[model samples]
Target chain A: MNAITARLSSFRRHLDPAVITAFACILLLLFLGSLYSRNFLSPEYLLQQLKVASFLGIIATGMMLVILLGQIDLSLPWVVTVGAMMSSAAAGFGHTGAMLAIPFGIFCGVLIGLVNGFGVAYLRIPSMIITLATNAVAQGLMVVYTGGFSPQDSASPTMRYLATGFIIPSIPNSVLCWIIVGAAAVFLMNRTGFGRSIYGIGNRERAAYLSGINTRRIVLTVFGISGGLAAFGGVLLAGYASKAAQSMGDAYLLPAIAAVVLGGTSILGGRGSYLGTVAGVLLITLLQSILSVMQMPEFGRQIIYGLVIIMMLLLYGRESLSR
Target chain B: MKQWRFWFVEHRGTLMALVIFVVMFLIYASNHPAGFGANMVQTASNKGVLLAFVAMAQSLVVITSGIDLSVGMVFTLTNCLASWLVVGSPAQVILGIIAVLAVGAVCGAINGCVVIYGRLQPIVATIATGAIYYGIALALRPFPGGTVNETIADALTGKLFNFIPASLVAMIAIVFVVWVPFSRSVAGRAAYAVGSSETAAYMSGVPIKRAKFFAYTLSGLLAGTGGLFLTFFTYTGEAAYASGNAYTLFSIASVVLGGVSLMGGKGSAIGAIFGALAFRTIGDLLFVFDFDPLWQPLFQGVVLLLAVSLSAFGLLRVRNRLDWFT
Candidate 1:
């Protein structure tokens, strides 16, 4: 009996409470939603929801990494915009631009991430301030690029295909993109030395350095990856929307952070899982859908999101305190 | 000489910020088409006070080593609430003012409860509360149409003695009424202690939680004051998401520029007020230079980044790298 109890406790340790809570919320939302609309339970409806979740999921993945490093990237909004704008603008060029469009967009994201990394890692600036400044700079650049008018370019065929296409019957191409990105994140975090170092740095930068982790380099690399991922999320969004618009990335910043925090990742860093973030993304997407179905106003949705975050923080804070 | 150097070093950040603000304002005034006239000064003061009030609110929490991202939202919510309440009659207006302040205090108290008792990180906790406050503001002023008592609005926002700006005077009154007493109080010292080092503060038998709570509550009140001023200036209430976000970001910039360390336990609201004024001047500078309005955000951002980066220079002088983390 003692052995059995120990095993169960071990299993519990493996299962994060935040993830469990998020899953339960998702299920509850789905059940409650279905009661209101019969179509809520339909495969098509859920699949569409999954596709939407994928965009947030991808952004949240990068957010989770930054959070794990005891840092944050507030530049997600502009970085995503850069990705979409660069790709779409490239598409307006000849075939070469079309071919290079996606890469160029991603490259913009990577470059921003590198800049973020440089500031945080070398200049030793706080990621929060650095990212915020970078975000402003990006906004300024984009504003100049668009020349205060609407972007004239539209999504390329490949971009549109990636956003709207389906791979395994019913599963969206965007979800496929998310899966690939998510898998890579999980592998990097779980299977590689780099992943462990992130946790170490998050847990304690000085200690991580003492342990020979090259803390600065890891911080730089992680920020870069985060930038790249945020940009990638933007690319998918543009594809889905069929074009890039001004300030298109604005909506994602809070939600991405919300998803990361909801997924059970510690805002203080050094502890969390991608699995929890996935659950968080799905839960938020479902909650949003349910709110829409209920014909709730945008303000109501914002209130609900805010209340839910505070409630979750309270819950998480309590358990840690008790221990 | 050593004592003088010590004093200079202690006040260096604040002094530097003050010097920067003075220089920027001088340059801005020199470039202005109308020069430093009463009209221009009044307008600038009116614009600066909005951010100044918010930055002052931010400084309270910042002093306690916590941040209040919700201050801007509180300002917005109170502005919306004021537009509705500050209209009816003289007595009604007085009541409206009290109610707006009360609402601000209550919002700050809520943030206090979450961060102190709930033990949540200030950033996330305030972000959540900020959103909630913004939601409330949106609900109150969905279409952005309301009226403030024009008499009161004019009295507060307009020039005093037909020479000095009434807004600047009111700002000074608030400084004396709110900031002076708070900084001199035990609770204020406790906040400073907590900001410098929480464990050390606790060990010193400071009422750490109480200090933090008061900091947050006062922050809300100041933000609410800002909101009331907004109503006075605009004579209407509009729950603008972008504006609220901008204020939040700019408040941080102002705080940093004012010589208040983001690390906490340093700087003064006076410095922050100057910082806000300087920041407002940057936009004016652009206008006077005939730059495209679109370039405002970009220029402001670049200037902010450069200003903030200056603070990082101290990191290089630290002998122990571990000091960087702290």
Candidate 2:
């Protein structure tokens, strides 16, 4: 009993205020919506919301890894877009081409992620600046290639299976995919040597290096994983939307970051949990849904979202200060 | 000859920018004969002036080892205000300008207070503020359509003398009046001290919070000026105009390319100005080549990456050379 209590206290220390507030906000919004709106309790609406959240959840999973290393991938949106474009463009070539495109998409993501990781980890350049540049490059490339139009064909059967198809009648295949991915992520983050090494590096790179960890390699690997995951999310997105547009990934960027931050992950790096990030994703999706249901204007929604993030951050910042 | 060599050694980045500019100009001239004259020059110069101001604003915050992601959003807000208020009489136009600057200053002051008093990191705090500012702009003008006085626009777009553009003149005047003092004054030196080592600066009696507040306020003022210029150039102010979504990256790129250290405490105002000019010139060259507009963002990103890499390389070389001399 004492051991369990100690463990709980340790967990509490790691809990970010933003994550807690976000969770509460999600619950409050859902309760309010269910009370006010007639269709809020429907299985179809709930399932649809889950389906949307899955895409963000998958991306945020990889984003969690990157953030754990104290680095960010600003190029995520474009990479996701490029992946969708590649997937759709390859669809016309049949099954083999589609299969080939999956790796190709992942490869593209890895390339950009490697560039970002190398610049930040090795060259000691700021990650934000490098990722920002790469984002521009990636978006530009997508526009040049696609001309801002949706691509020609639907996603392949396998991709669609990952997106829209389901294990059960009511549950979305995407949500199932999210569950599998989330379980694997939780295990990897909690039980693996790599996970511990990531935390060590994130907390203090010099100290980690001194302790004989290959910090640089770990950083590169984490970014590569982030890239691959983002690309995978792109595949799911193509399946859901049934078309790959040029700016399809733009909307996901903020939510992915927000999910990671709101999941109790420190923006300054180190100390976070995948489970918390999962909760964070659900919370954000619910908040968006509630706002949309409330028929709020775009500007008002933005204002509320900004205020929530700021207030949460302020609370977290003050807590850390007090500590 | 020794003195000249020393000057070259000290200002290698500036010299490199000049060489690149010449090479790009030649490429554009050779490719598009019609674009080689005053028209191209004026447009490039005007873009450079606008970007230079933004770069300067970014540089001020960067010197304190912080960043202002809200610069572009603030620019949009001021632009909108200017458009809405300047449409009346000239007195209204002047008052409008004051109001816009005041609004900008207040926004920046809020950022400063949050960072200093509220103890928020500059990056996170500015990002949130950026969203708020963008939201306010959207609220003010949900869609695209606002008007500025044609006379004011003409004055901005027109030339001062026969050869020089009034916008360029305004830029130069701003540099002389604002940039010089901010970069050379006691407060400016204090800013450097704070950025270099905040604890040390505090121990030495420097008002770190005050210096930071000044930096943010000045950044806001410059952003306001940049927004006014943007309105003049574009002749309209929509909510989406000058959105922070893209300029956040561009301003940082310009500063980095200008040889400003991301870690802070080592760069010049002149370097930042030239950096903006070089960046604008590159874009103009691309336009002259008729590269697809869709690829522009990608090109900007690639160039930004290359610029950052090159800056790092330059720093390495400088460090090596210093070690050898020592």
Categorize the docking of model 2: acceptable
Provide the lowest-lDDT 10-residue window in model 2 chain B: B317-326
Task: Give the per-residue lDDT digits (tens) of candidate 2, residues A94-192.
Answer: 768777766676677788788777777666677777877777787777777777676676777777777888778889989998999899888888899
DockQ of 2: 0.48
Worst 10 residues of 1 chain B by lDDT: B303-312
Return the DockQ of model 1.
0.59
Query: Model 1 over residues B219-309: C-alpha lDDT tens digits?
Result: 9999999999999999999999888888888888888888887778998888788888888887568998889988977888788778767
Clashes (candidate 1): 0
In model 1, which residue pairs have backbone atoms overlapping below 3 Å? none
What TM value does the first chain of each candidate achieve? 0.95, 0.90
lDDT of 2 at A201: 79
- Model 1 chain A poorest 10 in a row by lDDT: A314-323
TM-score of each: 0.97, 0.91
